[model samples]
Target: MQENKNEKPFIPTLGITIGDMNGIGPEVIIKSVMNPKIFDLVNLVVYGHGKVLSHYKNLLGVDKFSFNQTNNAGQIRYNRLNVINCVEDIEVNPGEETKEAGALALAAIQKATEDLKEGKIDAIVTAPINKNNIQSDDFKFPGHTEYFTEAFGAHESLMFLCGERIRIGVATGHISIAQIKDRLNADVIRKKLELMLKSLKKDFNIGKPKIAVLGLNPHAGEDGLLGNEEIEIIQPVINEFKEKGELVFGPYPADGFFGNSSQSKFDGILAMYHDQGLIPFKTLAFEEGVNFTAGLSAVRTSPDHGTAYNIAGKGIANEQSMRSAIYMAKDVLLARRENTH
Candidate 1:
């Protein structure tokens, strides 16, 4: 995507939250900021401990990596990586899940969120966090999407997995398979579809987008012999959109849809549940996918994968997804500006 030629050259300041240090968050973050090309697009600021970031810089042996360490975003400089020390100095453990690491992760997110609310930063790109350890009285939500929804004051949010080719959103997120049936309803499905449609038009620059919705059951309930979700609930919603002259179609069998490579036909897709969308998404774009939280008042995104504990600190974790997340945030910020103007 190109910037509007009539508009002034604008660069957004993006805040990066360093997830659990024991994970590959710091490793990928250090690698991403070290590249000089990134500075040409936007100013970078990391929300984490400067000491731990320095430790990882030395561990990775990247001599070119240097950051301006400060506590205030106003002091951030262009063409240099900036570090905001949100947590105190602590031990650097690469692979173990410690309470300290969890605390640090949450601290970075909280500080970044605060800054976003204050307009200290333009957008946020979060690293992977261990959901199990990050749980506390303050963060009782299941994952980032939920926490961000309440934090940013959005009535609803969609877990939209974005790739170069295909983008998929889920109606039900971070829930068990058994609960999928009970959690899904017309209201929830309609809200997710609304978010995806708006995001595609505003954030993706698609004037009119074609959307596909996946069925909850196999063979789309095999004509209601297997299950009635498609016949009873999902189809009614699809028909309602069709009546309004919207380009929405579906209740497609999830297995056959991807199996037949049908995802390429649409601009966006809506899945009934989490695994139904993520499994195929990760398989196709494991190293490049971005998990974007749509329908929020603020811009937020994250790497599609999690903290690879087995490969943590190995310096082998792929930074493509991290890099992609950063670029996506920049793209969305610019797109939003153009739309608002």
Candidate 2:
């Protein structure tokens, strides 16, 4: 049920998938939820094995924390971390990639996704999973964005890397840099812009969002001296939006656009490819960034960083990104609710 605007705020039941138990997924998750204040925001439910979490809880030496162990979401107790067992007696080998860990990750994802579909949970905050290990017959997508996009039957989705100061959406994702030119076209760029526009309005409450589009080549193709893509492909689309009276601009040179911090002038940014946007975003806010999949029918968010295999079980993994993801999921869900009402 939607919360009434005049009523007290409703606490959302947020689901978390313990991604790749061997990595720092479990550790960061535990640390994020350890604070009692989180319970005041939402009902937290984790989809993973109790035994694996117990191992990490002991490894991290968290003695004063407690949680409810169950296979049912309906039995989740408020004010305590609740874990729904998705796998049975899984072994955890930190800093190592194994088929067992992959299976556990997939199981939790499948279970939480099912719950989300059935309205058993409001939204999901996923921890980092090793993309290489989490491949199987049931899961063949490139990453979580693609997986959830397909699962929810969205024609396309945007890999929106969001931080406090800026938000960026990629025109193409999880593809080779060589293939960007071949895959990128007017239709692709237009779709991404549409998704960004709608998400900024509905998910973020930006009624008239100003967006900046980044060029694919050096110096934004230097007026066609560097590349023709900016002239032939990108600018035409930007002009199309402008002709329609939309607040979209650029084919700005990727280097100078971000290098000069021009991102602050717009509400959202559209980068031509992955590394072009992420390298700068991570550099700016790696610890607090949230990777949100926009345009999906349901709300899903994950930490901007991946599984830190080198730091797995080291007791030093930063939980701020994980915490931010959980909070972002709740915020987006609330935004969606408010827009609907």
Candidate 3:
């Protein structure tokens, strides 16, 4: 589907949460919004402390731009960078994770999430957060996907990583390798596949998306030689979807799938675990991938990277992934609107 430039554009308001203050989240976000073209794409409301952003702006030598402060989401200034301070009197220490940093990160996310649910913001683009540090009684999910699933009351959500060419959805995310086998089940696989299919059609505007499902074991269990997940759980779901006339295929070996460039043949891919899909995805599209949460009522996206503490305040953190996340969120929001209409 093609967007008509002649039509009146629907500019969305995007809420950005600062993930870990000690990480490269603020640095990358500063670099991303510095481009005037980004302001043209969407009205951005940053949910973090102004002091934290100010420190990064100076540390990174980004002096020409300034964030317009606002106390309310409705007061966001279009065509400019706006900030809503979620914390006050906070000292930012780059390249070090602390309880204060995690607490502030959670505060920012909480505020942004509330605004997103209230329809004050059309979409949300989050920065990287430390899974270990950013833990509290209020925030107890494994990662953002599970948090959003319960927050938005969605039955299921998919951790979809997308770039210009490849899009992958992981069935299980942020879990230990030892727990993967027990977690692999037909119900889980089927729900993930359904979510991926729906997101491809509605959010990506793909009418008939062909999805490739990867096997859990080596050589897809070598026909139950290595494991029975392929035959018992994975293949059954694929067959069920196929019999229903869906363009789904494979319990293909994970190694050959990306090694042989088979990913280019399909519109999307569904992997049984996190590393199986992400390792190949990052290798291929790390610099420009966006982590999109599919099957949520509200759109949310983040850079396909984590807090680069080593490069936090070095002023060298690549902003490409963050920029891609912002643009992807806008595109997905637009596509969803078009789909609904």
Per-candidate count of clashing residue pairs (backbone under 3 Å): 0, 0, 0
Write the residue-wise lDDT of candidate 1 on 132-211 in tens digits.
89999889988999999999888999999999998999999999999998999999998898899999999999998899
For model 3, residues 1-341, the per-residue Cα lDDT tens digits are: 78788998899999999899989999989999887888777999889888888999889877777989998998887888888988776889999989999998899999999998888999999999998898999999888878888989997899999988999999889899999988879999999999999999999999999999999998999988899889888998999999999999999999988889999999999998999999999999999999999999999999999998988899989999999999999999999988888
Task: Provide TM-scores for the models.
Answer: 0.97, 0.97, 0.97
Which regions of candidate 3 fall more than 4 Å away from where they truly are?
A: 1-7
Q: Which is the leading candidate under lDDT? A: 2
Given candidate 2, what's the lDDT at residue 298?
Answer: 94
lDDT of 2 by residue, 227-285 (tens): 99999999999999999989999989988998799999999999999999899899888
lDDT of 3 at 263: 95
lDDT of each: 0.92, 0.93, 0.92
Question: Model 1 shows how many backbone clashes?
Answer: 0
Q: Report the CA-based lDDT of candidate 1 relative to the real structure.
A: 0.92
Overlapping backbone residue pairs in candidate 3 total: 0
TM-score for candidate 2, residues paired by index: 0.97
